[model samples]
Target: AGWQGTAAQVVTHTLNRMQDEFATNPADCLAYIGTCITQPHYEVDERVASRLPETHLKPGGKPGKWMADLKGANLAQLLSAGIPEAHIEVSPYCTWADNDHYFSHRRNEGTTGRMLAVIGIQNKPS
Candidate 1:
């Protein structure tokens, strides 16, 4: 099966860093695939959300694609965890817009193909 979602990259970077720091030589990573549901700019959805005291997002439109916000937060967390910024690479692929290339659970409505990434780690022996 193809790999799914953008989280896979982050997952791999994290694993790779851990393996290196722990002197594990090399390591491998698995797919980080799952459902992702966030606010869409649909009129009806926005209208309903406006009435709620607490919302899925802040008042002024969506916050820079909260999915991306979560990603940025994840990036920060990983950095705090000792992973360098230069070591981590995040794709700018937008699921909703890059449907032609990347598979989107939302755009394809559960019938989409996934993309996979292959990482190899040759652990150093202690």
Candidate 2:
């Protein structure tokens, strides 16, 4: 879902897909929680911006542009879908701001190395 479209579209589409998974398997959906990278200054078309909340959006430096909060938008979607706030976690790191520790296609011009994170539940022996 990397820059597939405007932040609004990406967040909405991603939440829809997650909701589908939740419907099929609520337990697994809860276990598969994760966060989208924060986009402090994501520019989007006015049309897209209009669909997002004003609280999660900021005026871009130029006209007809917007800075979106992709993380906050995703979080709100999870909350609306009944995901507990305690079960959800948001990373404070911004890839662009933490270029030394994270890969940011926008900051690095798509020349950065890949990064991977994995989480799972280990069942107790029965």
Candidate 3:
């Protein structure tokens, strides 16, 4: 139940199926990024939480604690699909953490001034 029922569940299942169909290595990943890890230094939103195995919160962490367990599970799923860990890359700036750089809907007071940042391998120029 680590992630079979969580949002990451789709990622794992999808990646596995993609590898099986395309006969590609996980290193040839077909996915994107994860979530923002709960940092002690950051005053994250504790309202976001998950079930034990489905959560990245440490043991004994309260329900109000922030969690990115699904994100971690997604990474593992990609690796299991044959993608190398080295290929995975993520940044807080893409999440709600970095408001100034990355527009956050909530932090921006539901303003439409948020920036859309996409992460993926750039295709070679034709």
Candidate 3 residue spans exceeding 4 A from truth: 1-8, 30-48, 51-55, 59-64, 69-71, 92-94, 113-126
**Candidate 1 lDDT tens digits, 41-96:** 21123444333223223444444222123334344445544556665665655556
Q: Is candidate 1 or candidate 2 better by TM-score?
A: 2
lDDT of 2 by residue, 32-56 (tens): 3233346564677787778777777
Candidates by TM-score, descending order: 2, 3, 1
TM-score of each: 0.48, 0.65, 0.54
Compared with the true structure, the alpha-carbon lDDT of candidate 2 equals: 0.62
Deviation from native of the Cα of residue 9 in model 3, angstroms: 1.8
Candidate 2 TM-score over all chains jointly: 0.65
Colliding pairs, model 1: 3-115, 3-116, 25-123, 25-124, 26-121, 26-122, 26-123, 27-121
How well does candidate 1 match the true structure in TM-score terms? 0.48
Better of 2 and 3 by TM-score: 2
Q: Which is better, 1 or 3, measured by lDDT?
A: 3
Query: Candidate 3, clashing residue pairs?
Result: 26-82, 26-83, 27-82, 27-83, 56-69
Once superposed on the true structure, which residue ranges of model 2 sit more than 4 Å away at CA? 1-39, 47-54, 117-126
Give the winner by TM-score: 2
